[model samples]
Target: MESNSSLGTALLPEESTETSFWRKVLDVEEVKKQVLFSLPMILTNAFYYAITLVSVMFAGHLGELELAGATLANSWATVSGFAFMIGLSGALETLCGQGFGAKTYRVLGIYLQASCIISCFFSVIISIIWFYTEPILILLHQEPQIAKKADLYMKYLIPAVFAFGFVQNVLRFLQTQSILMPLVLFSGLPFALHFGIVYTLVHWTGLGFKGASLASSISLWISLILLATYVVCSKKFEHTWGGFSSESFRHIVTNLRLSLPSAAMVCLEYWAFEILVLLAGLMPDAAITTSVIAMCVNTEAIAFNFTYGLSAAASTRVSNELGAENPGRAKTAMAVALKLVVLLALVLVLALVFGHNIWAGFFSDSTLIIKGFASMTPLLAISISVDSFQGVLSGVARGCGWQHLVVVANLVTFYGIGMPIAVLLGFKFKLYAKGLWIGLICGLSSQAATLLLITFRTRWTRIDLSAEREQGTLDSV
Candidate 1:
């Protein structure tokens, strides 16, 4: 009875043990794959983000009023419009990502179309709000002159909003497929051209401040045109993209369910930070306090762009593996991403700690403002590290189709727990900007911890793709 089966069974245990070891411990190949994936994404995102910033810079050169107006308009546009568009596109990270993994290639194109449609619809609604920026800014207690200038900037920037929506959706679509290299060229090219375009429009043309806003519109459209042309014309997407279809319309409601919660998840966290700036304005030397907080917020945003790539990579890998029915692999991908983001965050925090004075100088030469920012650097460092954790974890949540849960988590942590602590410490305790920032840290930490717990406690299991497609919900496995 010494059969071949007995001999094979004897060797199976060692093979299983080796496989389990790799699964449980650090995975070099997976880390390498993610590294390669994240770098390009970081560059692509940074380039695209700079395009808008460049426009604000050009507008600022005209005068202080133009700067204030452009800055306010930019902030309002982000809170009310850009952030939502980014959130709406997050649905594709789940749908198209898993669909690609499942080899249901055609759905990627359908989801892309559906997401674009949703973005377009929202852009229209948001445009209406942008039209009345002056009143809203006045309602928020902003100076009337500044509010009027912002309205002028926003009016010209409206067309860009629609283009921006499409760009974000396409980004998710391509990112899920691991088609990243093109993104660098698509985004980088426009960003490089944007500077010249802005300078020409603002200086060469007679448009001045208005030219800066219009330049943004043109540059964004350029990005959309390039990306859209690539997706439509390239044979690489032959399987994933079938030409326009009515099927996309059917998926609109399905996409909306996921999109809305995802938008809330992003907006809650964003608005919380914006609120801190508003709170800073209430402090006794309002000018210095507001400037310092705004600088910190800007610094944090720049830092986040670095980790955003890893977050995107995490979402893509987890979703794809889940779609392929490899739960263990999906979990491992998330682990690897978390490790990378933490290490990256450490490097960034070190830079901030050592170069706080230098970095603050870029925002303002006022010694008082610079010194104030220096005082807040350590708090900024802590918040940055905490944000890195949540960024990647949020990506995993998207991969797991848990945006709805994340929305609730953001609300509770930011508004319920974090904000109250901030108000108490900031005002009652007289911690000023530092106290307010500390409160933000509390919220961020709670959110990060909650998301981490969610990732661990929730089972990483295969999604029932057929049932989900039929029911139009990507709930828990």
Candidate 2:
């Protein structure tokens, strides 16, 4: 309570006192270290996106038909997977954030177990999805040629998809600890494995799309193994790997309850986009391929990784400060995160707008395809800017544990209003692909605006540090 600077952007009246303007945007000295922490994460995540782009690059080279089929199948896979997995794994962030905040390490182990169980439970559902991949593609009534190609490509990913979902849960647990390097390394392992194996398998075995999928699947399992082994070996807990107790299970259940709202929030957000892809199918071929532009712009995985990493750090910073009972610092941290997000968004816009022509060339050299992508760059830039806010606030919401409210916001903005309009414009008005993207932009704007408002209104609020008691004297750390 001892300071004020006139220049600071005091978001709350209490924080405004004598704080410098820059300080309002961020607590420079304190947040500096966190910026460093976030940088690697951003880079790591960017690498992830880059890897996916590489995958797409390889597939795109296989011919337009292969590219379209692979992209469609992946769209379905990601959306469906997020429906259950993100909701389930989010418990890790909530419980882990609070646990670290309160120095409640013992309880974190319990939450970890719960996250694992929930992830595994959902993995079963995702695995079974392979059985229906062909059926679902057929139901789309796409040309039989496209459907058949998509089904086979999807089948290859089924095994990998199982491992991928579970691995993400493990990564979440690690991220909560703010020990994200392992998660990054572990996440990359699969990409490496996939590329190496896919190249060889596709060339020699003639499995083509199926082989590539299997490569990705094997890579996921490899990643999972590496991370699980790390958790076992890490010194943070002497007996973390010890068998779970009923009390631990109870604590785990509590963590799940806390995280379920977040899961729903994530699922609803992604599912809306999933619906967009389906609706896009109703358009013409040139129209459908036009989506490849959105997908490409949206798929700038590396760029997104940077934002998500920053957001993750923001969540940790907010949760930790709040748990330490320092609301002022929490407010500062949130501001810093928001500022960083906008800054990052600006960078993305510039890159896309100026380099749209060049970027498309790297992705493909087809003049017709290249021209379509270039035309959409400006809109793509806008979408990227808006999404930056969405990504950041999602972390803010997680930090504040407002999972349910976030979902409600997502539904109202994206589904209740955004999707319907996009569909109407696309079909009725004949806006085609442009209509679809406009709809997406509108929805993202909805999410970003609402999340920013929420973060501001809830400024400096405390994260719940409460947790079920540990099983015994063993959790004293």
Best-performing candidate as measured by TM-score: 1
> Per-residue alpha-carbon lDDT of model 1 for 53-147, expressed as tens digits?
78977786676567556766777787888888989999998888888888888888888999999999999999999999989877887667767
Task: Look at candidate 1 and tell me the lDDT of residue 123.
Answer: 98
How many backbone clashes does every candidate have?
0, 15
- Candidate 1: C-alpha lDDT: 0.86
Residue 317 displacement in candidate 1 (angstroms): 0.3
Which portions of model 1 show Cα errors greater than 4 Å?
1-25, 61-66, 284-288, 365-367, 462-467, 470-477
TM-score for each model: 0.90, 0.87
Q: Which lDDT tens digits does candidate 2 get at residues 63-162?
A: 7777666666666766776346756776666656666676766656666776776677777787787557767766865545666666787777767556
Quote the positional error of residue 428 for candidate 2 in Å.
Answer: 1.8
Candidate 2: worst-modelled 10 consecutive residues by lDDT: 465-474
